[model samples]
Target: MLAQLRQQAILERVRRTGGVRVAELVRDLGVSDMTIRRDLEALADRGLVEKVHGGATIVGAGSTEEPGFTAKSARQQAEKEAIARHAARLVRPGSSVALSAGTTTWTFAHHLADVPELTVITNSLKVADVFHRAGRPDQTVVLVGGVRTPSDALVGPVAVAAIRSMNVDMLILGVHGMSVKAGFTTPNLLEAETDRELVGAAQRLVVLADHTKWGTIGISTIARLEQADVVVSDTGLSGEARAALSEHVGELVLADPGADEREAPAP
Candidate 1:
């Protein structure tokens, strides 16, 4: 109970301040240095914070420092899984789907393991690996060639060129942040351009983002909210958020973390 409370407090402080120092945490939480270190380590393990030399920072804080894959994998486990499950349902067998690279998108790849007769085009080494290792023989995987980003994504001209050449049935995209004004934004410029091209290549675009993405703005805008065909999020979203999203997106699908069913707004 004490650990959970401390964890929650750390999360709140991180959200408020964008980052926190070990000494500051010890002073503010009134805990021992060892205890504070443990807290930070646990948070880092969960992908909530990036452990620095003396402190920790938020994963996507306006900086070039990228969180390690292990750390990212730990953060938002439940939410990503739920989003992936919801995304998998949108894909039909024998259809070509383009998946953008991100931890959340990687989760979507896992759920596609059983999807028979599907063709996937992606720029993620992790996504390709998932399909190569377990994907059925009937399924075809096309991995775009490009320089890999810190988040294990391939972007830039090579990736953009590949996307432009092919037409995909659906695109499952992930973003660093989304706002009514800012649209879909990311921290990396090259990634933003590649995402824009991906959106253009697909007949339908579905954005997979969690509630935490609300209100935050990144450096570059890929597309507006209205540009997305569908948006899938968790039930933890606020009423205002639901209404705000409904105004832009054609369909809003809210998935319950506890169940497989989804609450979708009427067409």
Candidate 2:
């Protein structure tokens, strides 16, 4: 149909240019102003674009592939916080956990401050700074040394080597995308390689991702779906996604931003 073609063209333009104005859409798609508005609204509903003052921006736009920290931090604040709170419950006091880099992972670090007598290891300077500012002496923090990525993650051979030497109780991983085939993936190859090392060093792997990550494919995969012990995601996930993930992961915890209790298997 004409609407479908217009939608595809709009999406392609947004992906190529990072964003598009309503006026621009009207001009480019040769559609009316009302039609362009409807298309944008539909795209925003699907989590593909974010509506702003004059127009919409692709949700995750950049040559970097991953959204910048500030942009990502603002996109799904409530959902990430809810996911982090639920993930924090999985970590008990006096346990060692490895937290990966990303805005979602950073939110998890914030929720973790209340947890006492925990050792947290990470290659994220931002995460380290947050914990340092909180000053939880009862918690021991390990900052992995390596080359920093555009997203502020420490990666490369040095980081991978350091991560391989330590064993942790749990690994809370974050990624750019998650597909049945790709499992868990990142845009940066070095970061993906480092993630693999972290996965190998932990007894349990818990993935922290929002619903938008579903069905997307990134540059490199770190682990298979079956390799994850648990996956913590927002309730925005589709029914098909929930079923697909449940088949491979031991537990799929769905956190509703508006609710206190999360939906998960009754263990």
Candidate 3:
């Protein structure tokens, strides 16, 4: 497994067991003790884990964690950028797309400015601003009016009702967190409702999230895993995560900083 993916697995193991022994990881992952130590050390640097004498334990872990846009934007920058680029490839010119609110989708909005003759609808003020700043006459940008959350998402009955009124070619979404069981989710309940409306309005659902989001469950479920047409995430996702996502999602696209998006072999 890739080093980053290994680290993710280690972190998950630590979260589950509260701590993981180096010997167990070595046996389970079929890696050297030194390699496991290095993975633990790297996770420690990110404050995700705390290294003990022979293992590491989760640090300040909780499922209810929800960071604001600014806080989330600071994380997984390279991963998010690569995911955005790969997601842009899936967009055709002159098609309508809806974007749900979150930092990753906001980053993707920056990429969509160049796609010609597009109609963009979003519940995110930041996303609308990206297109508005471009001031493209050929592209139509619609900002749905509603209550804004700490994540800068406009969510409420107004947003959901407005989203139900239009159909789009694609819906590119960003979530607070996601998991095998919970699927794509948001921390805010109303945002989840609004996102569901957006999902129903699109023919294709493309979710853009980094590796860190894997196995993290939020407050509300937007859709089951099978509902997603595609999931674009970082290569740092563990083998187990990739397998689960492949089994559930229609397409699993892993973004790498240096290469084109990698896809699982189709059955």
Candidate 4:
């Protein structure tokens, strides 16, 4: 495809989906990675799209717009995979962890099942299902029941009530959008409350978000950046975002999905 045609296609995809990954475009267009990157850069320069590390998104997606699980799952595949791998390292065996509903948390649940003697308490039906499928006696998975959101999360009073009584070692939260000013947020009001409760119930907060989440702001704030113990993101996170998040969150680690799998946390 010609540069103009390819760029137009890129913009149209971003317009329809709110985001487009270069890898996906490369496969579909049968072009080089550098060519796709160049096309995204040109579009970004024209104020038509927002350029991110691995992809581009519809400009100004921060304003209370939220995509469902599948939409999110498709946006940043490699980044989520890398972040999940690193987040999994934080879990020591025999620890109780709380996972919030989001695509990244669902990915983390897959990795958590491999750990020995872990009890996972989560508001995500998808996360619970991972353990259910694994059928591991040593790993106990708690599925918090509540109102189901489009993102496949169980939120609201029922989830909050359950979270209030239990304390966990960590809360691995996936957010709709995050920023220095907005902190961690969700577009759904009830989900925000449940996420806050999950944050409060844990000894530590580790947010698992991809780079695209940086500038987006949801309707409700769950917690401030300083409240987090750690933030695990992919290397695709922009340098400026990395600097800002590192400053506020204290410990910001980047995950390279291409890296060989590191040893899991010691039991």
Query: Quick one: best lDDT, which candidate?
Result: 4
lDDT of 3 by residue, 212-240 (tens): 88988888999988999999999999999
Candidate 4 local lDDT, 169-226, one digit each (tens): 9999998778999999899999999999999999999999888789888899999999
Q: Distance from true position, residue 138, model 4, in Å?
A: 1.2
Q: Candidate 1 clashing pairs?
A: 46-75
Clashes of 1: 1
In candidate 3, where is summed lDDT lowest over 10 consecutive residues? 257-266
RMSD of 2: 8.4
TM-score of each: 0.77, 0.76, 0.75, 0.76
Runs off by more than 4 Å, candidate 4: 1-62, 260-267
lDDT of each: 0.83, 0.85, 0.85, 0.87
lDDT of 2 by residue, 219-244 (tens): 88889999999999999999999999
**Winner by TM-score between candidate 3 and candidate 1:** 1
Clashing pairs in 4: none
Could you give candidate 1's per-residue lDDT for residues 1-267 as a string of tens digits?
Answer: 398899889888776656667777788788899998899899999999877656776775562344434335555667778888998899999999999888789999998989889999998888889999994899999999888886788899999898889999999998888889999888788888998998999999999988777776878898999999999888878899899999999898887666643455556
Assess the local accuracy of residue 267 in candidate 1 as a C-alpha lDDT between 0 and 100: 64
**How many clashes in each candidate?**
1, 0, 0, 0
User: On a 0 to 100 scale, what is the lDDT of residue 33 in model 4?
Assistant: 96
**Candidate 2, superposed: residue stretches over 4 Å from native:** 1-64, 260-267
